[model samples]
Target: MRLPEHFLNNRKLESLVENQSSFTLDHAAMHIFETHQQAEQVLLQFDQPVLASMIEGKKVMHLRDYESFQFLPGESLVLPSGELMCIDFPEAEYENPTRCLAMAISEEKITKVLDWMNETMPKTGGLHWGLMDYNFHFVNDAAVFQILQRLVFLFTEDHPYKDYFVDNMLRELIIRILQTNELKIYGSDTFTLRENSRLAHVVRYIRTHLHESLDIATLSKEACMSASHFHRVFKNELGISPVEFINNERVKLAVSLLQNPEISIKEVYMCCGFESRSYFNRVFKHKQQITPGDYQRLLQRSMF
Candidate 1:
């Protein structure tokens, strides 16, 4: 997502490389960085966990365990405390600067939220609420994108009760981020399922039967629980409802199918168990910020 034009216009031309403007709240601090002119091997480190979101232009990120990769707009990276970053700017210029927002959050704040979550809404299969200790880079999902946009506004604007608003937002942001991370792990082909756990059995069932009509009653049977209880437990454990999880799985399968040039969009939706074209488009667009057809076209252009 793009930053407000007013914020961009008011930036001071202090440095040609990685210019910084800072804003602070009680539990976190946000720094807006703008870089002009090509730069290489620029080092950055944080004392607290930092969430970095790209706003404009591009960067080549060199981090542990990951090969150098392009950091583009609508992408984000999460780094743990004291993690070092080496960044490269191949396309920075006076007229075309690379802009990014880095938000550093306190460890205590994170710990408090994690403790509360584990106590009140414990995850299934003995999983605990926590953040990844290593660097995590991902495309901005719709929920994350919306939260980041609101956070930027809250941090940049002047308000007497700024910390109160931001603190609440930060709690949600943390929960959403953890939920996204868990979804990635659970949805991965390599993630092993513990056969004894109810959630594992239900997840396995859902994955295998995605092409069929899935209802809560059927899924609850897989978990050996009633439909109402299963729904509540699933949402509590995963931070998403059973229906949402099903739709997410369907959309993910649709994405994989769409990559094949031989697969028509209709075929993709049908294979993913979508009842109609319009419903598929709406669900896919909501998650990915683009219609299935548009996404496929963009994919084709990139490949060719």
Candidate 2:
């Protein structure tokens, strides 16, 4: 899908912020910045650290409290909050200008997601690490490139419900990150899923039983590991505990249901596995920043 003309026309890189811009729910807090010529080092001081995966090109990052490193396309990097960093593009030759996607997400939002995980699955703590940095060689990884292209189109589009589409794309992008991690863990000749393996069986179990009542014990049993050990392995592999993973999936389902005007909030609650309407409302509102009814109204308004 091509980006709408309006969004493209409205694109303004806010320079005053000094490498950062205000956050917006309209597009998953992501931005694509391109440079035709090598520019001076870009310094960014973020309120919260970011998990950044490179989509294309090469860049060097000087991170606070971490060793400086060069990130090629298809590599991932994590920048912790309050940390200052300098990013530079050192490559001298490029047929096309270098491009990168800067996804700025709130630590608070991520924490909420983590909180949901602990609530639904008490055994799981959460991701111990705060950063995810990676590079993707889009030339070789055509599939990953295609996903990024789709996102670019959505971001440039001017549709009334562009934010909705962008949010969906963001979800897809994150899923791709998980897939990348999976491939990295399992592609090596020595890759193994022993008790300490990041590719634990619990994640697969949860994915298979989304509609079922899944808890720490059930998931741990599926992995044939103790609940505590399972939780530790899960957080190490997926960046979030098993419980948080389930709630994120549930919220994703709830959002899909809310998009359908025919589906009532009460119905959504039951369908998504929430036993109480009030609790569903609370969780949905906290994650989505709006009540289910209000979300429906916004969707309707966008349609018109």
Candidate 3:
């Protein structure tokens, strides 16, 4: 998950201070905002729904009743159309200004995409497309980041056939955004999307049974699809293979288990489904950048 720093740096302009530089096409717009001086309570509203991503520096966002939070690099916020956001540039200075992009999207284009998704790939168990709502912040993953970077190129291009390109990219961008949103809400209390989606059903199964031996065949059965078909669809929908996702979920659980100083590192790994200590240690360090024992000690120190 590297941030799209190249696109961010390329888009920056010298006149930084609500300079209002934007590129627009048929169904989407990219607004690049840079603030050189510290500012507070800067009001920003979009006529269409916007996916605001933090490019550089940081911002203190105050949206609706949600408490103030930092919008740092490698993060994004999906907002509804006509929503007013009050943002603060607390760290903006002459040398280091806050840079962000607000990509306002056309409702008509979104509706068309939504209709197509529901019609073709209709969720078997839950809601269809139209995943965009009031949910604000999200971490940028590879799929979402790549399409967004492509869009930077598309928006800046003056080619006459750019509209066709815009149409294609807009569909992709919106779909990726929707998928990102769905992933965000998957297991949380707000997750109500039950499209009978095979990938989602498989994912839901994996989340519930992370401690068990979840082989591909068993998971495929939960999705009611053949093993090979399930594998392809799972990776396509979620951007990760079934095995990688299992390990990710296990690692997430391991982090929580490590917080308990009473639980030994060996016990933590076993509970999270790792077969051996060496393997567990390698995976833990790879994902968390620290050994499980070190993480446990860090947690132990914090308790005091």
Candidate 4:
């Protein structure tokens, strides 16, 4: 994946604080910012998947095509790449005005870490422990918060070995995230059955083939189940029917494609696996509650 040109230009730098008070990190990284200034819809674009955690103050984190989460001092929120997030701060201010950190993790690095842990940690059965759903909150322990504080200090301070320290600390931070076991939703079951596993396989397949025609019968066959049964089980497992899930995934791809001015809407429609422009528009508007042109305009407004 081609990262932004600025990212390539600042590869060697550990941290950059822009005039807008947002910080950027180049490594398995987190951008930390603290400000009392009221933000007018702060939107961030990540080249890699990112986890944004609010270490201080109450803030609202909203993600497109996912869920929204409210973070207190000790809570953290996770966001995937190509996801647009809106952060809103409380109107009444006390001690601070939205101090948060955005951590970016390379997909390749995460895969390698998961593979290593799968081989080394027999109990996990090759499952990636750091996998988090969009907009979910994980309460941080004291140790984790301390590590984050140290990282912030290292990032802000001009120490001689800042890069070395930051890299080692980031590795440790990933280990902490892997070891965390506080993931749960109220009144939700945590077990997986054979049927649910099949549904998960279907979801993974859809994600992998976002640019291809996703027929229900083909997907059902891929899951080794009848179409009716697959639809029922998939809806039960993922809280959405298979077809809805596919359309949602396509809309997500469409939003990403719309970010590029070079790609025409027609080209984006075909590239994102829409059969026709009208169908794409219909689905996009139905999901986003706005037409693709309006969505692009919103993004452009945010850019300025």
Candidate 5:
């Protein structure tokens, strides 16, 4: 959702019937699509694995083996090589068009990362570190979204070391996707399935005690490892510190509380396990880029 400002302000999304634009790098390319008419059953396919995200408007996606669903902004879909997709733009118009981006990553680059993972960070089960064979759909979490935003910027921006920058970003995006898939499979659906995995163990403890006081020492105890070792491996596995993850969870709780006008903003911090108003405000603003009071006012304005 980190659309370029120029694109947002004064875009000439005209003349072209389909409106396809591209920005290509050595290892990665971003293909943009915009539809100006009501289109049904538009077939799209990619030669390489792509992370497709909805930037604006909506799409009815019909993957090969999955059920048809509405793909909206803030959602991402990862497709393997040569996966065919049938998309429907039910609400596209001249003024309100459906826009999406297909981030095609090279096969050689993906293989390099997978080889590293299989050798260095293999899973507990028989599953190896490979891309999902089928379609993988997920809500865009903050970490994943931030990486996507950066990748988009890197793809479009003209930097001297653009390839180097993109390689790092692509590597980051791959790791995040892999960890997300692992969590989707083992952490959420089958928590008991991988009790032996220290990473999964710590993730479970974090989710269960999201509102409770969480510390690296306590989480390391749950993982049965030293605090230092836990900190290193946890970052390697999940791409964030243990305390940042806890704060993210707390902010999630705070957002849910803020939806209700009956609850005062002063009460939300304590209910979400924050210690004080100043700390809560700082963390909330840091995470969401807005203070709690402004968020409350925005929500109120939206409800009107």
Candidate 6:
């Protein structure tokens, strides 16, 4: 998304690099940081938990205990309140400046959301819903990207009810982030060994039986849950329905299968347990924004 010309022109020339512009609401604040020259070991910290996303250019993040990694656009990192960040801008220039946005969220707002989640959502292994208390860096998914874009608009736009709009979006954004953290943990290969979480066992079962016909009843039995409760818990925990999760796993399998040049599209879909080619095409297109055939063709072309 492009910054408005007025916003760009109106920024105060406070510093050559890491110039900051802030917009505040009742429960949160948004900040835009632009760096116009090469910089090293730039220090940043937040008094409140912050969700930081790269808008343009690159940054090398230096965090304790982890190797420095490139922070690029379309990626985000969540830091707990007061966590220090050491960032480097190696490619900032007058013509191509590095830009990033940080949304600092109030503890009250976080508590409200966490209360609602704990009251409504049920987690396996007797875990309660809480924001992970460490650094979480990930590439933004579609839902996350959409919410961030809306947040940028809400933060910058002039409106009579801007606070109300931002509050609602903040709740949603927090939920999305929490769900993403859950997915990251439960969706990993290491999580399968965690026997206390029935959901993890269910995920393992789904992976092993991905090429077979799967039904809610069978999966519910695996989790020792009733069908209705299973569906509700799964969706509440993962923010996606069982059918959606199964299809997603199937699509992942189809992607791996398509890597083999010898596989036909029909065979790929069949082996991934898709019911029919047309249905597979629809689901794959919806998930990947590209048809399987097109993806395969592109892959083949890249190979050659």
Best by lDDT: 6
In the range 1-304, model 4's lDDT, one tens digit per residue, is 1123443344343322111223434466656555464554566677787766665566666767656666677776666687776766654243334556777777876676656654554221123344545555577766678777777666666667787787677766665665453213211234342444555566667777878899989999988879887776554334346777788778988998999866788888988888998999999999888998888888888989
Winner on lDDT (3 vs 5): 5
TM-score of 2: 0.45
Deviation in angstroms for 149 in model 1? 2.1
Specify the highest-TM-score model's number.
6
Clashes of each: 0, 23, 8, 0, 0, 0
Task: Count steric clashes of candidate 5.
Answer: 0
Question: In model 1, how large is the Cα lDDT of residue 266?
Answer: 90
Provide the lowest-lDDT 10-residue window in model 3: 1-10
Tens digits of lDDT, candidate 6, 252-280: 89999988889999999889888999999
Ranking by lDDT: 6, 1, 5, 3, 4, 2
Candidate 4 TM-score over all chains jointly? 0.49
> How far is each candidate from the true structure, as Cα RMSD in Å?
3.1, 16.5, 3.4, 16.6, 5.0, 2.6
User: Residue 9 in model 4: shift from native, Å?
Assistant: 26
Residue 181 in model 2: shift from native, Å?
6.7
Tens digit of lDDT per residue, candidate 1, span 1-304?
Answer: 6677767788687899999988888899998899999999999998999999999999999997789899999988899988889999999999999999998999999999999889987876687877764577778878889988998898877789889999999998888778767666666777775667788778888989998999998999888888998998787666688889899999989999989887899999888988899999999999998999999999999997
lDDT tens readout by residue for model 2, 49-103: 4445465567777765567677666555545567676878766233444555656
Model 1 stretches astray by more than 4 angstroms: 2-6, 9-11, 255-270, 276-304
lDDT of 5 at 262: 84
Query: What's the ranking of the predictions by TM-score, best on top?
Result: 6, 1, 3, 5, 4, 2
CA error at residue 206 for candidate 3, angstroms: 2.9
Model 3 misplaced stretches (Cα beyond 4 Å): 1-16, 189-204, 232-239
Q: What are the lDDT figures for the candidates, one per model? A: 0.87, 0.59, 0.78, 0.64, 0.80, 0.89
Question: What's model 6's lDDT at 159?
Answer: 92
